[model samples]
Target: MGRAWILCKKMFSLTLVFNALLTIACCVGILAGFYWYYSGWNPFAPYLVNGNLLWFAIAAAAINIFPSALLGRKLHTGRFLFHHYFYGFLVMASAVIYVVLFTSVPLTTIFLVNNTSPEVNVGRFFLLGGLTLLLDDLPDVSKRIESGLNHIKAGANRMRKVIVAAQVVTGAFSLYIFAAVCAAMLTIPEWVTPANLILVFTVLITGVTAFIFVKRKAWNNLIVNGEENSH
Candidate 1:
């Protein structure tokens, strides 16, 4: 038990270090890509629309990065509660940013379509992502906050299930959110396009596949439970 705790401690530190590195890399890479794509435009232009879109994309990217980052830490430390709180923050931040962008960015630009009707504004993306993360992490967090039980593995598994479900649900709902945003900008609202729908499905599949690896890992330790004295 002591050794397991030690390993968990190490895992936590390593995960944090890894996430810090990846976050920096992703942020720099994404910003560079944006700059390259919009090189012709004056980045400082006072237009809130484009600027907001850029911000939204960046914020969303950060939100997406949080799980991997937290997982990296949890994989090393086996401490579930700490990372759960971090994930909750990530979801909350992403939700707020998505809502802001929903209002600021025109839907026509997102879909490259024309519409005569006003966009049907439904800022559900924020709620979806936030609620999913919350649903996934709350139990673990509550357990940790309320008690000091070693529920890391069980919590991890629960999160995996919730996240997998979220991935599946988000695949469908995100399109609606995107379509609504685009329709709001005079583009006719449509069902989620095939391309975006495919992307979401692909993500769901990947997450499901990845869960197997993590699932096994949560129990890969050599120590036998209830037999700590023998060691």
Candidate 2:
């Protein structure tokens, strides 16, 4: 049993690491897409170049996305629903702030550096990403849950717990990023542009990676219910 538990832990760690890598890859891909799609064609490109405030927001986004992706991936299916929801909400909130600041009316009142912060852009980013994430994951969540029983059948409760815990921690980190962004928006000067967008992407990615690494390191030592008895 001890041997089995150890094996479970090992597998769990590997899955999480792999998932993290995948999330990073996804962010990079998205960044490239953003650049390619908007660089020369978008009317807002010059605004970003001139305002220069977008850098701060980009920095924040880069720092936050990594963990948000992981949290979405790691959230346990059953017992930690609230945690998952919180993280999802946080992600949505951050996305909304960024999108609104960039796309619509002048964000000067808030970030003080944004170009046109149109009211129509209000919460647009959040609405887009939040809905997409929710829609994308809803089906997967159900599939994962339905299949989870097989894991239990194989005496893989330990495995399940690890995955679930990873999810919870990921969610927590999302909340943290959300808080950090809110704080930054309140305190820091606002700027907008492609460069700033890149910065935000980087910041979000870095933030997520840092949180996952920290949380996973701690989670490794944690013993689920069957740790002692089963082992």
Clash counts for all predictions: 10, 39
Show the colliding residue pairs in model 1.
8-77, 11-76, 11-77, 12-77, 15-73, 107-182, 115-186, 115-187, 119-183, 119-184
Q: lDDT per residue, candidate 1, 89-144, as tens digits?
A: 67667656655564554533322222112221233333334444443344355545
lDDT of each: 0.38, 0.40
lDDT of 1 at 133: 43
Decoy 2 TM-score against native: 0.27
Judge candidate 2 against the unseen true structure and give its global Cα lDDT, from 0 to 1. Answer: 0.40
lDDT of model 1 at position 190: 53
- Model 1 local distance difference test score: 0.38
Q: Which 10-residue window of candidate 2 scores lowest in summed lDDT?
A: 222-231
* Tens-digit per-residue lDDT, 1-231, candidate 2: 765655455345333333333333333333444555445432223322322233333333333333233333333333235433355456677766775555554333222223323543344334444544442243234546425533442453345455445444544443343344444444544634443343344445444544554556533443323222110
